[model samples]
Target: MKQDIPAVKQPVRSKILVVDDEPRIRDACRMVLSEQGFEVALAADGNEGVQMIQQEHFDVILVDLMMPVLSGFEVLSHVREAHPDTVVIVITGYATLEHSINAMKRGAFDFIPKPFTPDQLRAVVAKAIKYNRALQDIADTNSRLRTMVNRLTDGVMATDRDRRIVLANPAFLHLIGYHGESVLGRLIDEIHVSDQVREMIGQTLTMPSDEFTEPTEEIACSDDSGERIVRAKCAPFRGRDGSTIGTITVLNDITALKEFDRIRSDFVSMVCHEVRSPMNSMMMQIKVLLDGLAGELTDKQREILGRVSEKMSGLTTMVSELLDLSRLESGLIANEKSAVKMNEILREQVSFHAENGRRKNITIELRQPESLPPVLANQRNMEEVITNLVTNAIKYSPENTTVTVTATVENEYVRLSVQDQGYGIGADDLKRIFDRFYRVNDQNTRTIVGTGLGLAIVKSIVEAHHGSIKVSSTPGSGSTFTVLLPLVSI
Candidate 1:
């Protein structure tokens, strides 16, 4: 049996209508446009072309001037009124200055002479289509951008290199305490907070071409109430000839975040003081009982008491650390600067840690140069700095492993280092090791124990002494903690 098959029709192409009195010109134009994938229709006169345009949709129309019945001007006007988007190109055999001008005035896209080549017609037609398409694309993109800019909550402002505001979002207007009408075309310094910002703007603008290419850093500006921090990014804008004509800047406000941090720090200090008062009294009572000032007890009872005392001691230390950290962050812990011997301080700290080191079977080595500079620091703060680092070294290190405590003068500063051969800090914890209540290791369970304030207190004390502390470690190779103290008042 034979099977029946159906033929499929190709999709219709874009339509083009040709209106000319000359039969040869119309035929030639139709043949060229038809070969170039346009569905072509021919009209003998201007009236016929207008009738065709009114009846059907055409993407482009080629009309001839000086027609027999109704002139090309009549057809052009009628098509433009009825089908506004249909491109109208006038074709004239006897080209005249007045005729070409009239066609353009009547909204004709282009006027082609009779002697024009097929390639010329094709190029002009393609260019006109591309131009219209590009214009439509730009309109659509602009509509979307305007909608987005209006909807955004953050302030956004774009300025030319001349520092004049070009475009600004509603958020930007609100942030700078202004409205659109007040800000446009105004220099940045006009709305800028103070003399400092005005100077910064001037400096940045006057910067050599090389430096201005990079983004501006985070800047702080003082407003009516307080300071506001904002991150600013800048990029050079170039013109059609690719020369840097201006710059664009984006500002993001971070004032609320900074204020929140300050409030949190104050609350922590209040809580730490409350907790420290009670813990200090409790530890004092425990110390009295352990010293036998309360009464006598058996060896086993004393041993049990000793363990309890040790744990209480840990709690007391934690409370002290909390107080120290709170004081440091709140800026309440100012250094009581004094010119004191760094070596004498180190020897005393090492001697104190040596007692604890002996129980762990760890060797404590003190390396200090005899002629050491007197560091400008509070004695108590520097002592705590030494004690915390040395105590940490003892805790993490194994039996008989060496803990080296060294103090030496370098570059008008006293450098104290505690080097330990122990389980070193993990890579992830290195950056935040000094943050309060942050600890490294599975040994950080409340049972395995720490108030997690050791490094934090150490950091606070070092800073209070007008010093900086740094720690470097490897997973197995062990760690080195260094404190740098200025030799003179700073």
Candidate 2:
């Protein structure tokens, strides 16, 4: 039985055509070309050669100048007009300087003397094959790149150092409201870009180098394409010499994303308002009943009603938080900032949560040096952030565990960290702990009641003040929440 084996890969062969009236010359040329790993074809004369050229594609062609029926010059002329990419070499037994000059003038790649050695022929063919392969590769690469650029959905453009448009892909033409004409040699400012995009482009071009600015991602506006949100980025297009050649800008349309956000924001505002009305009514009724305005109740009845009031209060707090978050997102919240002593704020929050902590048998401890640096932040926002952090620490900690609030000065910022000894958060849950409505769904903390918006609110408030917040935690050990705010320079 024949053994089952993979076939050896064959190398790509360059095709060569030999056109000579003499059979001896044709056979000799074919043998020399084939030995050099080329696929060889032959013709008895110039007429036959022209016919073969019309029928097939060859990388290199060897033609004899003098032939029957048709002269070598005619065949060369026809091939040059029809298949200019093919490498053509002329060979003849009757050699002359005029013959070589005339052959080269007719677009012959090389002129071989009569009675040429096989070595000489092989050397010429080898050089032609290398040159042909390089040209073909470059053509293939350019074709592929052009296809890729045309198919892109994101707009891409390149401009010269003087800001003249050098290249614009199809998507870019659609974005700037132009087509058909090659915009390569046109000035970019003359293009029909919408006013908003033009202003952004102007900023990038003319902004002072001393005044550095962050690259903006999205801009919303009306254009010929209707409303759109174009997210663009620009970079210095560089040359091989490591110098700035121009700028390349890429743009992506995010209109759908902006629309979705608008709808979601409106929906949240509507739902929160609807729920608050009924909740406020229930709270008032609960207060009336707790005050004995309804009827005298037994000890158990009062206890149950009291717990009902507490639960109602928690729901009310959550609703208020939702309203606050919605207002913050909508930019409806007034940024009334002032000099805020963080130490005083921390004391106030701890005192307020003392009663709630007592219910859980948890204690709040404050740890900081005297005369802490004041932070430039909204007083109300700071209160909310501190309260949320302390409340969460107490809520998650087991009975008798103490929650500590620490303040310190670091560089130009005030760093406040809240540490708690609770059923610690897992590594995975810790990552998304501050996400709105994100909770650690672990067996250990499943019984813990939370609205899941507390930490998210804290983070939003901290960032709104141009500060930052972060959490550090370990399973079965504990977690620490830290907030950093820029300290008001004296």
Q: Write the per-residue lDDT of candidate 1 for residues 1-490, one digit (tens) a residue.
A: 9987777888657778889888888888888887988788999998888888889978778898888879989998998899877788888886799888989999998878988899988887776666556755777898898779867876666666687877777876665656445677888767743343344444445545432232345566665667777655455555565445555555567677656656876776677677767767877876787788999877887788778877877776776666566666644332434557777888888887888999988889999888786775667877777777888888777677889988887897888899999778888989888887887764522344577787888887777556799999987667999988887421
Per lDDT, the best of the predicted structures is 2
Q: Which parts of model 1 have CA positions greater than 4 angstroms off? A: 1-111, 117-119, 180-206, 212-234, 238-243, 267-490
Most TM-score-accurate candidate: 2
Cα-based lDDT for every prediction: 0.74, 0.79
TM-score of each: 0.40, 0.47
Quality of model 2 by C-alpha lDDT: 0.79
- Candidate 1 versus the native: TM-score? 0.40
Error of 2 at 6 (Å): 12
Give me the runs in candidate 2 sitting further than 4 Å from their true place: 1-13, 18-28, 41-56, 61-124, 127-131, 159-167, 182-190, 194-225, 267-436, 441-490
**Candidate 1 C-alpha RMSD relative to the actual structure:** 15.3
